[model samples]
Target: MKKSTLALAVALGAIAQHAGAAGFIEDSKASVSSRTLYFNNDQRDALSANQRSARGVDQRETATGLKFNYQSGFTQGVVGFGIDAQALVGFHLDGGRGHHPNSNSFVPSDTDGSAVSSWSSASANVKARFSKTEAHLGGALAPNLPILIASDGRLLPQTFEGGTITSKEIDNVTFNAGQLEHATGRASSNSTGLAVNGGSKESNQFRFGGADWKVTKDLTLQYYYANLEDYYKQHFLGLVHVYPISEGQSFKTDLRYFDSSSDGKNGQAGYGFNNNGGYAKNANEVDNKTWSAMFTYALGGSAFMVGHQRVNDDGGFVWMNQGSVVNGNGGSEGAGGSSFYLFTDSMINSFVRAGENTTFGQYSYDFAALGVPGLKTSIAYLHGDNIKASNGSGDQSEWERDMRIDYTVQQGVLKGFGTTLRHGAYRGSGTGIHDQDQTRLIFNYTYSFL
Candidate 1:
């Protein structure tokens, strides 16, 4: 199906024929969530063993996911109406066929390459409101805007299929606009058209607009613009502040910037760009400029962070990648993972190439200030340097380190049951990129039926 799920099933059959429409069943909501991952990757420079058996390179997997959501409130007012729905399922309890890897990146592969025992999908969204404005339409769009970031790392969450609007009429300002065309891949149940990382031509128009101005109560400001009709055009700016330093301590600041160019038929030939493999001034076009800054300090449950980023010797740093879009039954509409609203987006590296320069730091802790309630921990590190190198052969360097821990189950029958453990390590030298190590273990739960 997917014509945005047949126009959200004819707008949920006209909102289920207005089933007693008074505030839509008194403001409904429902939820279900579950996740379980256990993924591992090693590939530390897998040089041989036939290049680690043709690149499946030391992997491991496990999956479990379930998600359900429903929301329907609005429906009693002047112009209110609503519906939101989502459903997902993934289950592939283990890997092995030399650890999966027919490239749906994390799962969904079976044509003689294994993995893919279960998969499911569903989506809907139709909404409206007026007064402070709201609008949404079809296919579970998940946008955490600043020019787009919707990739929940794996096992589901990378959705989009069109239409959005938000307003918040004045008072502290917030506005957004959108028009996404297609994407659905956090492990494929197929939906694709949008491209960038090594574009194989797709781009069914993506447009955006943005705002966020909360000029006080600890300042904020942001701006955005985006376009992808034939391959790139982005702009963004941001700033945030919080400096209270007294009662529990605080000091935070963030800044970001981006500017990109090259749109129509970018660098031609199927709209090329492989800049992520570094250096690209005019070769596969799309110029870029990036910037970042971050600082944080909190004291109550301890937190500290630091950052710096820059990548602009000419290219690299672009988002929305359908990972070489291939579909029409030729397999893989796996939409190749993406996320960008960068703080160097890392876990196994994404110091966005072309003349890179990154530096990062982090430390976190919260054990309920040592009374240990729900626990937490963190560690991070990144170090990128100069990078460029693409035959002009010169600079390159990379580094990564990450760690995490979390726990939850705060009160009764497994209160909120959560657990996580993560790890990462990466290293590189000339940037053909291959040293790696990664791990994840997660479990989560949620249930609410209201």
Candidate 2:
């Protein structure tokens, strides 16, 4: 057994004795969340015979997901213990052969290149608390940090197998640390080692640490560091501030920066980086610096946001991506989807090519101000240019536009029911990327039981 699995077993055995303790039973909480999603992607660009054979024309599918969660509070003692468990199941509602891609970015695919009927997974985390710090060890970790963002764009959310510690011992400050060994993809039931896009070999170790400091009520600073053994190392710094202009108006500024470099074995045969199909000063090596700044102004129910991001000329930005990681069966492990923390991580494409400069803006409105309690809408656009290509190819440019609408029931039995509709269109020139339009419709509801 893995060390983490063994540790979890021992911890669970120790905590079993106190499962019925006062605080444990009294503070327990349970909930079930349901999500149904309809996804459609239309490729608009023309393709050659080889391209048509390898890449499908488009993708359209629908799936329903149910997640059940149970969180038990810490037992009463100097050192308290608890457990968080979750079960997830996904069912394919619709999608035929020609409309569904064999790649499992959205839905699990069978051997015959068809969607699976259903899939399920379950996990539990053993936790302990001391002072103001808490630690968890399990296979169901979903981390939202500067170095990693658990992906949830599809029917189910990606999960990790690892241990994490969080502490708030210092006032106005938070600390986080973790080590992940494996990950379960959003559409996969099995867990696999970590790797970036184009990397076939997997790395078993991914360590990260970070701190967030609230300097003031409206000001915050963050720093984080991460390392994927034999892959890459990265550091991130961020700052956020909000300035109040009036009773119902404020201005917010957010800044982010990242520095990444190759680690042990990086650029090796199976550990090479593709640079997202962009230029790299040193072929197959990780070397990049990126920075972005965003400003937002809010007045009443209206808000506007704008941002600019730049990627250094050395290489394209990099993040954890298992898109090309092959499984034991010599097939994709259904782990192609991933998420990164960047304004350029749009619905269809991420504009992080080397030497790229991107400008983005968004406008949003809430209908509550107009007496519609649970309605909201937003639209955004992003344009990127001066993207350097490999082999001394000419630079490229791209643009994307996205729109979203969300509504929720505010009363009666469906008070928490939510509906979200989103659409995005992307066009690129000289980038070798296909132009596409995408749409997603989602319904969500959650029920709580204490």
**lDDT (Cα atoms) of all candidates against the true structure:** 0.83, 0.89
* Top TM-score model: 2
lDDT of 1 by residue, 258-290 (tens): 898999888998888888887887888889889
Q: Identify the candidate with maximal lDDT.
A: 2
Off by over 4 Å in 2: 46-56, 326-331
Against the true structure, what is each candidate's TM-score?
Answer: 0.34, 0.96
Q: Model 1 residue 78 lDDT?
A: 77
Total clashes in model 2, counting residue pairs 3 or more apart in sequence or in different chains:
0
lDDT digits (tens) for residues 280-342 of candidate 2: 999999999999999999998999999999999998898986536544434454774778989
lDDT of 2 at 257: 99
User: lDDT score, residue 339, model 2?
Assistant: 89
Q: Backbone collision count in every prediction?
A: 0, 0
